[model samples]
Target: MARGKTQMRRIENATSRQVTFFKRRNGLLKKAFELSVLCDAEVAVLIFSTRGKLYEFSSKSIKETIERYKRHKKDIQAKNPPVEQNKQHLQQEMASLMENIEHLESSKRKLSGEDLGSCTTEELLELEQQLERSISSIRTRKIQVFRQHVEQLKEKGTALAVENAMLRNKLSLQQERGSNKEKATVPSADISEVSDVETDLFIGPPETSRKRAL
Candidate 1:
């Protein structure tokens, strides 16, 4: 004879509930082991009971599997090099160039300050030419730096504008969602749950009932 099916309600007796939990847990673990063995597959299972007990199973060393997954991820990232590595390399080169440029400018300032007024007219003219050339070079570099700064500011401004638009859209969406949820949770206008509450507070009751209650 077939046993009767259990009802879909919480078990009233503690003993029966415990027995059921034990039987089911063992059956589930057995099935998982059988699946791993039959399919020759790696599997990990973690179970937590209502009593705060933990159960775990793994077809392979869990740590080894996780490490293998990380290795695969690293390999995939290594395959794509142009955009990331090239950008980083270019940035590093630019920074080094800027540093060397600052050092050279400092040295030039020191050289300009050294006294050469007692020198010959020919030497003076040569020095003047050198000074002009240095000034021209400095002016060119300043222009380049200014242009780069302007371009960077423009890029930053554009990014900020995009971010602000996204935030505004997100805020608008959140407000709309909140309004919809409020409407759903509220009772219908026809139902009027608060109408009686308002009346009880403001309206005078029958005189006889009031006197009797008092």
Candidate 2:
């Protein structure tokens, strides 16, 4: 059967932990040296113990390796610049925006008659004039709207009156027609009178009839 894998955890015994540290440090140094020699590369390693003991490895002078590493980092950073300049620009823009906002807020407050203790006579007069102009403009707009509303109401009233008159006329005409129809449907009495002359037996003789006719 395969052996179980060793669990990677801290050594409970202080002596064992120190021994493990020494062994790992030696192994790491040996690997660093081999990598630098075989690959012809610069290498550096630094390690510190819990008790403040220092351990290090460098293919060349440790100072030279540190300086070279710093230069390489600087080159990489130069290749892709940081956003410090952009951040500064954004901060300046934000500050300017905030200043404008504050200025607008102060102006609004002053217009509302708040914080007026610092106003000079000229400023007060100017503000009053501005308010007058604004009120005049508002009143003018309101008057125009009211006039328009009145005109609309007048038009609606006129239209309603005309409709009412037409309805009344139609009703009157319908009643008149109905009355005429009823009159036509009823019968009327004849008012002719008879003559009052007498027609007695006058068939005696042509001479008598002629005398009577005369």
Candidate 3:
């Protein structure tokens, strides 16, 4: 028996819906294959059941058909690029576009505002919490920067301490050398004292007369 005419609507009965889906799916695929064979033309069909199962058919490879479709779209666009030429009509479209843009902008502005009159209490609290978190993050970054600065200063102090210690050691060594030189050139007693006075007076060797006097 032939099937009766069916209403154009969702089939509420699960079994009937499933049977219909199977029958229609097979029929569509058969018709697609027949068309491809008869016309010597590429054909591709993609179907999805209500349950989300996929069915696909292509005379040539699906990828090739998709690539050919894309090339055709591009060639058509290149041949006749759509343009809005009439200024008044364009202005009317622009005015409509501007109205939509303004409406969206106003909505964005309203959402960004702090006025909680129209917003739910939960949303307001969430916004406030986010702001607090942002502030906390900023403060944490600030503290980290300060800590880095302090560490840099501490490193500089350590370097300066080492340099100061080296300078003090050099000064002490120079002072010790001066004291030793003064002690090594001490004067002898009596007439040697007189030669010593002469040697102290002059940096050269003691005079022969002074040595005889000693």
Top-lDDT candidate index: 2
Error of 3 at 99 (Å): 10
**After superposition, candidate 1 runs with Cα above 4 Å error:** 1-118, 186-214
Which 10-residue span in candidate 2 carries the lowest summed lDDT? Answer: 188-197
107-214 in candidate 1: lDDT tens per residue? 565457654555678866776788899899999999999999999999999999999999999999999999999998777764775564422333466885567555
Deviation in angstroms for 159 in model 1? 0.8
Tens digits of per-residue lDDT for model 2 on 72-112?
99998888666996788889999999999998998789899
How big is the positional error of residue 167 in model 2, measured in Å on the Cα after superposition? 0.8
Per-residue lDDT of 1-214 in model 3, one digit per residue for the tens?
Answer: 9988989999999999999889998999999999999988789999988778999999989999999999999898788665644566788999999999997776566556734577777867876787789789999999999999999999999999999999999999999999998877775434465653443343455575567557
lDDT of each: 0.82, 0.90, 0.84
**Between candidates 1 and 2, the TM-score winner:** 2
The clash tally of candidate 2 reads 0
Q: After superposition on all CA atoms, how large is the RMSD of candidate 2?
A: 10.2
Instruction: Report the error of model 1 at residue 93, Å.
Output: 36
Q: Clashing pairs in model 2?
A: none
Ten residues in sequence with the least summed lDDT for candidate 3 = 196-205
- Model 3's number of clashes is 0
Model 3, stretches more than 4 Å misplaced? 1-80, 85-119, 188-214
Tell me the lDDT of model 2 at 84. Answer: 93
Quality of model 3 by C-alpha lDDT: 0.84
